[model samples]
Target: MLQVRVKPGIEDRIRGFFPWVYRAEIASLSRKPKKGELVVVRDFGGKFLGYGYINPDVSIAIRILSFDKEEPVTPELIKKRIREAYDYRKRLYINSNAFRLIHSEGDLLPGLIVDVYGEYAVLEFTTYGMNRFREVVLEALVETLRPKGIYEKANLTAQKVEGIKVREGPVYGEVPDEIVIWEHDLKYLINIPEGQKTGFFLDQRNARKFVRSLVEPGDRCLDVFCHTGGFALNMKKMGADEVIAVDISEPALEVGRKNEELNGLSGIEWVQANAFDYLRELDRRGEKFDVVVIDPPSFAKNKHAVPNALRGYKELCVRGLRITRQGGYLAIFSCSFHITEQHLLEVLTQASYDVRRQVRVIAKTFQDKDHPWILQMPNTLYLKGIWVEVV
Candidate 1:
């Protein structure tokens, strides 16, 4: 394997279990290395740091998989990590079969994601280094899950950054276009082939269940960016009389409708439209709801986009607050790692001030336990939801 040494003082973080090494941090390389090559990283004094895979072209040059010298990156290690991740998920007691089996760095398998829905598993490789282990990953998934089929969802950003070529389709066996999965007495149809982020946003499972607690029988509820009617269905199931779900994607709205029928749920109004515009129109029409959920897609893909993302979130908070009846509940979520929980709280405060509405926070939720995050890497703890009551 090629050997690389980092600049003085850079090894401290690696020692602290920070998995990423930037290209600029490297001081010396044993040789000109190829992308996705296995490498041994060392400190300036030739002290062993970790074993990782290198991508010379990217900003994040190395993703260390093992810090122990005894444990090196190998096909067997990959399979063991997959099996261990499976064991962890099995103990989580997650309400649904659909869950994130591997959360990339969260599972110590950098650049790889695996989500299972019923008997099917969906995989995504976000780094060329991890993509090189595609065959091993598929083999491990088959061994551990014995699923009927496995599908691969292409991450466009990863393809662009890591120079990986991929097509979205089945990698093994036959995967159907849609599969039904149950969560807490609710049934949902997952379209693994075309749906966003590996068919469903399993990270929000806990939040979806928690939102039901705030809904009351015959209450009016609004679900913005209601992909597949997750929050909408829960509200209706909780006996809310009127539930309005809005999303920009007609296909997602269609799925939401199907999910409603699958759960034998009625009185859910599925609206296919831009959530921002729809919320404004609702305000103009003097529409108000007893409960409101604003769960938008990630507005910031990177740190550079955080300012605009905060602006978007503030607008959503302002609109969400305006349309919520006094003493009613409202929840706003941010799925972007760039948008911190502090940022959400600050934005909510400013929006509340601007709207002249006093609000009290009720609860806050993060990604469910199935998707564990490392303490060293805060980015792993993505997806934050803030629930408040308008006073």
Candidate 2:
């Protein structure tokens, strides 16, 4: 195994269990290191800090997997960690059969993600190091979940950034192109191969349920960026008189329509348009909704994009606030780690000031329990939403 030593000041964070070691923090290496090679990380003065995989070419040069000397990185360790992750998910007893089985670093399996949609499990290996453990991962997933099929979804970032060559589609048993899964009295039709983020946004399960509390039988609701109508369906299920779901993708809108039909739901107007443009149009028309949800895709993939991402968020928040009825509820979510809870609050405050709509936060939601995030890595807590009542 390759050995790496970090600069003096970098040892504390590594000792505190922060998994990543940036390329610049590295002071010395035992030898010329290869990408995706297992490496033991040490602090200055030659003290062992942790064990991880070294990816010399990436900005995040190393991702630690084990801090204990006895618990070195191995295929068996991957299997055991996976089983532990499954046991934890089972303990959650999430209302939905579908859940995030392994949340990459959240599960201490840095660089791997596994989402279970009923009988099918979708796996994404986001790092070359984790990809090397694919065989063991698959074997463990099978033994633990006993899913009808296991699908390997190729991640674009993994290919371009980590240089991880991947194979898409089913790697075990048989997987169908489409599958129907139920969550909290709502059934969603998932296009496994085609849908975004492993066919569904399981992270918002709690927020979807929480929205039901704010919706009344005769109130109107809007779900912007409503992929497959997760919030729209839940709003309608709560007896909202009218629901409008908007998204940029026509195929997603089509799926939203089917999902509505799948659940014996009707009257939800699915609109194929950009959510930003749609929200502006709604505000222009003076259309008001009793409940509104703006769940946009990550606008910031990296830290450099945070400023522009905040602008996008502010615009969305402004429009979301404008179209929401007085005393009604509005929730704006940012799925980017670059945009923190404070950033969201600040954006909302600015939007509120601009729109002249005094707001009071009713709730703040994070990714559901299935997608656990660790305190050591704030990036793991990517999905955040603020539910405010427009005053």
TM-score per prediction, in order, is 0.99, 0.98
TM-score of 1: 0.99
lDDT of 2 by residue, 1-391 (tens): 8989999999999889999999999999999998888999999889999999988889998999999989999988999999999889989967888999999889999999999999999999999888888889999999998889999999998899999997898999999999999898889888989999899999999999999999999999999999889999999999999999999989888999999999898999999998888888999999999999999999999899999999999999999999999999999998999999999999999999998999999999999999988898888899999999998
Best by TM-score: 1
Model 1: per-residue lDDT, tens digit, 257-356? 9999998988899999989999999999989999999999999989999999999999999999999999999999998899999999999999999999
Clashes of 1: 0
Q: Would you give me the overall lDDT of model 1?
A: 0.95
Which residue pairs collide, candidate 2? none
- Model 1, 106: alpha-carbon shift in Å? 0.2
Residue 196, candidate 2: C-alpha displacement in angstroms: 0.5
- Residue 380 in model 1: lDDT: 82
